[model samples]
Target: MTRIGVITFPGTLDDVDAARAVRLAGAEPASLWHKDADIHGVDAVVVPGGFSYGDYLRCGAIARFAPVMDEVIAAAGRGMPVLGICNGFQILTEAHLLPGALIRNDHQKFICREQRLRVESTTTAWTNLFDEGEEIVVPLKNGEGNFIASPDELDRLEGEGLVVFRYLDNPNGSARDIAGVRNQRGNVVGLMPHPEHAVEPGFGPDSPAGARQGVDGLRLFQSAISALVGA
Candidate 1:
């Protein structure tokens, strides 16, 4: 089975959900501790969301130096797929694995709601299962979800089609409505939404049929599994 590692930091709250999402996607989920330097040979890595280190010192600022992140950074450089969700996305940017930074919301308040996002690109490993221009709804919860970047960097991201997912409603004042972005090699992806929370049917976002029937986020985990299998 394809094994995916989910790293748990000191204050991580979504590691279990991430692991469950991996299992639902037909991959074995391995628990990786923040203090560890190895990934246990997993095919891919997922940096799940949560208030790592209690969100002290600017969200992910401190978690970037975790021992597990060292291995994650190296493995991602070697072409191993890595996905960072919400606070995890912050850490990726702080670690320079992905571009841009996530700052506090414009309203300076925590926001939690079902968010609509458009899949801008399917070239990344975590998005291959999605169709280009597809609209997906998932749960989004964060205080520091605002994504910001320089004009030049934003232009480069747009020019290279590196913007993976874009918010349809512009919830957090992210640059160009970017909800997610992938690195140049397309192996690393970071986004400010909680896809894992919407992976299971009957418990995710509301579907067209009714409430809590959406499984749109499941494709992300499945996409990674498929990518690893193809690799």
Candidate 2:
């Protein structure tokens, strides 16, 4: 089975959810602790969301330096796939795996709700299962979810087709409605939304069919598994 590593920092709250998502996507989930330097031979990595390190200093400032991140960084540099969600996105930016930064929402308050996002680019490992320009619903809960980048960097990302997911409703005032982005190589992706939370149909965000029928986020893990297994 394709094994995906799910990292757990001191305050991580979504490792279990991420692991379940991997399992649902027909992959094995390996636990990677924050203080550990090993990656446990997992084929891919997921940095789950939560208030890592109690969100001190900054959203991901402290968690980005955890020992396991060192291995993750190296793996990502070698073209291994990596996905970061919510606070994980913050960590990715802090680790310099992705350009730009996440700041407090423009409203300066925590927001928690179902979010709609467009599949801006299907070229990345984490988004290849989705059709380009299709919309998806997922859960988004965060205080610092606003994504910002310099105009030059933003233009570069847009030009290079690195923007993976964009918000349909423009919540939190993220720059250009960017909800997710990928590395130039397309192996690493970071997003402010929680895809894992939406993997289960009956318990995820609401879909047009009815309440809690959204499983659109499951495609993310499935995409990675497909890439790894050559499916």
Candidate 3:
């Protein structure tokens, strides 16, 4: 079975959710400890959303240097698939795996809602199942969700089509509506939304048909599986 590693740092609140999402996508989930330097040979990795290290120093500042991150960074450089949600996304940036910083929302208040995002890059390992320009709804809860980058870096990302998701409702004042981004190789992706929270149909966000329709998040894990095993 394909296995995906779910890292848990102290204060990580969503590792279980992420693991459940992995199972729903038909992959095995492995628990990876923050103090471990190894990746346990999992096919891919997920640094799920949470207030790691109690959000001390900065949101993900302390967790950025955890032993697990060193392996993650190296693995990502070798083209291994990696997905970072919310706080995990913050750590990726602080670790320099991706380029940008997530700051407090424009209102300086945490926001929680079912967010709508437009897929902008379908070539990434984590987004191959989504069509370019397709819209997806997922849960988003965060204080530091506004993504920012230098003008030059923003231009480069736009030019290279690395901007993965753009918010349709603009809840966080993220630059250019960017809700997610991918590395140059498209194997490492980081997003502010919590896709794991929306994976199971019955338990996720509601739909217009009065039935839950938030299973859209499942495709992200499936996409990574496909990329890993060429399924």
Candidate 4:
């Protein structure tokens, strides 16, 4: 089975959910400690969302120096797929694994809701199961969800088709309504929404069917597994 590593920091709240998502998607979820510098030979890595390091200095400022991050950075550089969700996204930016930064929400308040997003590009490891221009609804909870970058960087992202997901309703004032992005090689992806939270049908957001039957986010995990397994 494909082994995917999920890192847990002091204040991590979504590590379990991320692991469950991976398991449901037919991969082995490996628990990785923040203080450890090894990855246990996992196939890929996921930096789950949470208030790591107590959100001190910044959302991900302190978590960037965690021992596991060194291995994550090196693996990512070696073409290992990595996905960062919410605060995890912040860490990726702070660690320079991806471009741009996530700042406070334009509304200046913590927001939590099922956010609608469009799959703008499927050229990344985490989004390969989605079709281009597909719309999906997933949970998003964060105080610093707004994504910002220089105009040049925005142009480059768009020009290279690196913007993986675009918010349909402009939830957090992200540039061009971007909800997620991929690195130049498409191996690394960072997004503000918590797809892991929406993987379970009964516990996820309510769908139009009115049965709380939402599993749109599961495709993301499945995509990563497929990417690693070459199936």
Model 2 misplacement above 4 A? 208-212
What do the candidate models score in CA lDDT, each in turn? 0.92, 0.92, 0.92, 0.91
Tens digits of per-residue lDDT for model 4, 1-231: 899999999999999999999999999999999999799999999999999999999999999999999999999999999999999999999999999999999999999999888899887889988889877889999999999999999999899998999988998788899898999988999999999988877778854445447788898899998888883
Worst 10 residues of 4 by lDDT: 205-214
Error of 1 at 76 (Å): 0.3
Give residue 181's error in model 3 in angstroms. Answer: 0.3
**Which of the two candidates, 1 or 4, achieves a greater lDDT against the reference?**
1
Per-candidate clashes, comma-separated: 0, 0, 0, 0
C-alpha TM-score for every candidate = 0.97, 0.97, 0.96, 0.96
- lDDT accuracy of residue 193 in candidate 4: 95
Model 3 lDDT at residue 65: 93
Q: Model 2 scores what on Cα lDDT?
A: 0.92
**Model 1 lDDT per residue over 112-135, tens place:** 999998999999999999889888
Taking all chains together, the TM-score of candidate 4 against the true structure is: 0.96
Residue 114, candidate 3: how far off, in angstroms? 0.4
Spell out the clash pairs found in candidate 1.
none
lDDT of 2 by residue, 1-231 (tens): 899999999899999999999999899999999999789888999999999999999999999999999999999999899999999999999999999999999999999998988899898889888889887899999999999999999999899999999999988999999999999999999999999988876778766446437788899999999888773
Q: Write the per-residue lDDT of candidate 3 for residues 1-231, one digit (tens) a residue.
A: 999999999999999999999999999999999999799999899999999999999989999999999999999999999999999999999998888999999999999998888999999899998889888888899999999999999999999999999999899899999999999999999999999988876777754344447687888999999888883
What TM-score would candidate 2 get against the native? 0.97
Per-residue error for 30 in candidate 1, Å, reads: 0.2
